[model samples]
Target: QKEVEQDPGPLSVPEGAIVSLNCTYSNSAFQYFMWYRQYSRKGPELLMYTYSSGNKEDGRFTAQVDKSSKYISLFIRDSQPSDSATYLCAILDYGGATNKLIFGTGTLLAVQP
Candidate 1:
């Protein structure tokens, strides 16, 4: 299996809906999990980062990691049109600087009016 797997979701929902985006990984060495939000062609902005497991919350965004299940998820509460963007999950391997990062294909989220 690929190191990480995620639905490249062009998931559309009306404004005010709660959106849930997720990713699954097959690697056991990945310890750092991150959630990024990107608008159009711009680079991603770090939304949340966790060293291991548990949940992290920031504003309308919440990130959850379950190392035992190798799964991660981002929950956006009270969605808005401005929240329309691609969400990407990234994992940092412990290999060193050369290890770089592994990214999901990214889920395209559209919060409609």
Candidate 2:
């Protein structure tokens, strides 16, 4: 099975709205990192890195993970149209192999002005 699973959202939100994104996994080896991705000139860029369970906040963005439940999330406060993009969740299995990375299909977010 895939190591991580994220919502393939075509989610729309108005300006200043709070946006929530989510993912889930079924691997214990996923204790390493949960990465958030946004589109770049080349392709998907690693936007945020979160470790273990609990929440990590960076400015208007927050990444949360629940190791016990195998759940992960990202929250955006005061959403903006510039934030519109396809976001992906990635997991690294350090316990399994050397840099075995897995990624979700991605969720598309559209913040309307």
Candidate 3:
């Protein structure tokens, strides 16, 4: 099994709705959890990163991590069409130059106006 698991969802929603994306992991050594948003035909941009357990919020985006449950989530409030994109969850493995990231399959989301 992969270290991280997330549904590859092409989730559709209306504008102004709340959107939720989730991932689960099997690795307990993962210390940094991150969420990235990618627009079509473009590179992914880091949206949020949290260490261990806690919630981080920025405007309409919120990222939550629960190490105890090996679960992580990203919540988008007042979703907009501009928010439509592919969301990826990743776990950071530290090893200096050898450091690597394990990513989920990525969830596609669309918000219609």
Best by TM-score: 3
lDDT of each: 0.92, 0.82, 0.95
lDDT of 3 by residue, 1-113 (tens): 89999999889999999999999999897899999999999998999999989999999999999999999999999999999999999999886675888899999999999
lDDT of 3: 0.95
Off by over 4 Å in 3: none
Q: 1 or 3: which has the higher lDDT?
A: 3
lDDT of 2 by residue, 1-113 (tens): 76678889789999999999998998876775555557555477777888788888889999898888898888999999988888888888675356766888789999899
Best by lDDT: 3
In Å, residue 64's CA in model 1 sits off its true spot by 0.1
Model 1: per-residue Cα lDDT over 44-79, one tens digit each: 998899988899999999999999999999999999
RMSD each, Å = 1.1, 1.7, 1.0
Tell me which of candidates 1 and 3 scores higher on TM-score: 3
